[model samples]
Target: MVGRVLHIFNIFFFLISVFLGSQVQGRSLSVKKPDPDNAAATARWLVAQNSWGVLNTISSDLGGAPFGNVVSFSDGKPGKGKGIPYFYLTTLDPSARYGLKDPRASLTVSEYPLGTCGKIDPENPTCAKLTLTGKFKLVDPKSKEAEFAKTALFSKHSEMKDWPKSHNFQIFKLEIENIFLIDWFGGPKPITSDEYLHPKM
Candidate 1:
């Protein structure tokens, strides 16, 4: 009888934790998979819903080799995403370091995290993926855009507020020049930067 009671208590505790964590993160996407046929909407949904992705840069230390690092970003406050990902990074990290030098980078995100794919392989075309290629420019700390970025980033990732001050973490954004979205088997969808930024979602 005691074992069963403990098991029940454990499950209750887990449920509470999950609820609290989502509230803290403010990133519950509802796994709301939009119609895949709409390329712009699909791409925007992928960027807005997912918070972390692989940020690729040209590595200076590795003789200009292509480098990718897992990083966290946010397009805007919850439910009001602007389709432009903002990142908080310190030069100590290779992605930030290399990206600052070359300014050319790409951020890749997969829809697998939305948990709507079920058992399908992540690489499957039906699962959806997006790549944003452009220059990674640092936001001027004294500018108004920096204030907006701070709000956008912290709303989705609350923990960033408590990071060590000594790290010199700076706000950066992708000046998207090209967008590649593959949500179905036909082929890569051609999406222009303007269309992606101003999608009719």
Candidate 2:
């Protein structure tokens, strides 16, 4: 009888734990996501929340072929985003070198990493993804924009501040000319650079 009682207790405890875990997951998914109808707001939210993305550029060394690299970036400090993604890159890396030879580039970010996608597949239309295509220009180290870039980057990624200075890291910004956003099943939303930069949200 004692053995049977212990077995029942074990099963009861397991069920309780599973129930609690599901509740926690549900709460995380409940985090507010911008309405899909608000194209500009949704695009801005994706850029503002994501810290890293795939940055694609024209490769100078590879006969001008398309090259993509994983990069960390920041739009602004926390909730105050300007909708322009800023990156800290070193010419020691191919992406920065490629950007110098050809400024055309794009940055792609997905909502999956944010943990708000719930059980949806990442490729699902409702999961949302954004790509900002534009010129990748280096920010003059002596310029005011460079200062803001440093603060913005260091604020989100503190380890960047302590990275080796010998690497000669520099700030780069994507001068967005076009924006492609997919947040729903219909298709990509139409968002202009002006609308994305000046979102109502």
Best of the candidates, lDDT: 1
lDDT for residue 200 in candidate 1, whole number 0-100: 70
Question: Which stretches in model 1 have alpha-carbon errors above 4 Å?
Answer: 1-27
User: Candidate 2 lDDT, tens digit per residue, 17-52?
Assistant: 767864553222222578999999999888877888
The estimated TM-scores of all candidates read 0.87, 0.84
Q: After superposition, how far is residue 163 of candidate 1 from its true place, in Å?
A: 0.4
Give every collision pair in model 2: none
lDDT of 2 at 158: 78
Measured by TM-score, the strongest candidate is: 1
Worst 10 residues of 1 by lDDT: 22-31
Candidate 2, 153: how far from true, in Å?
Answer: 0.5
The lDDT, on a scale of 0 to 1, for candidate 2 is 0.88
In candidate 1, list every pair of residues with a backbone clash: none
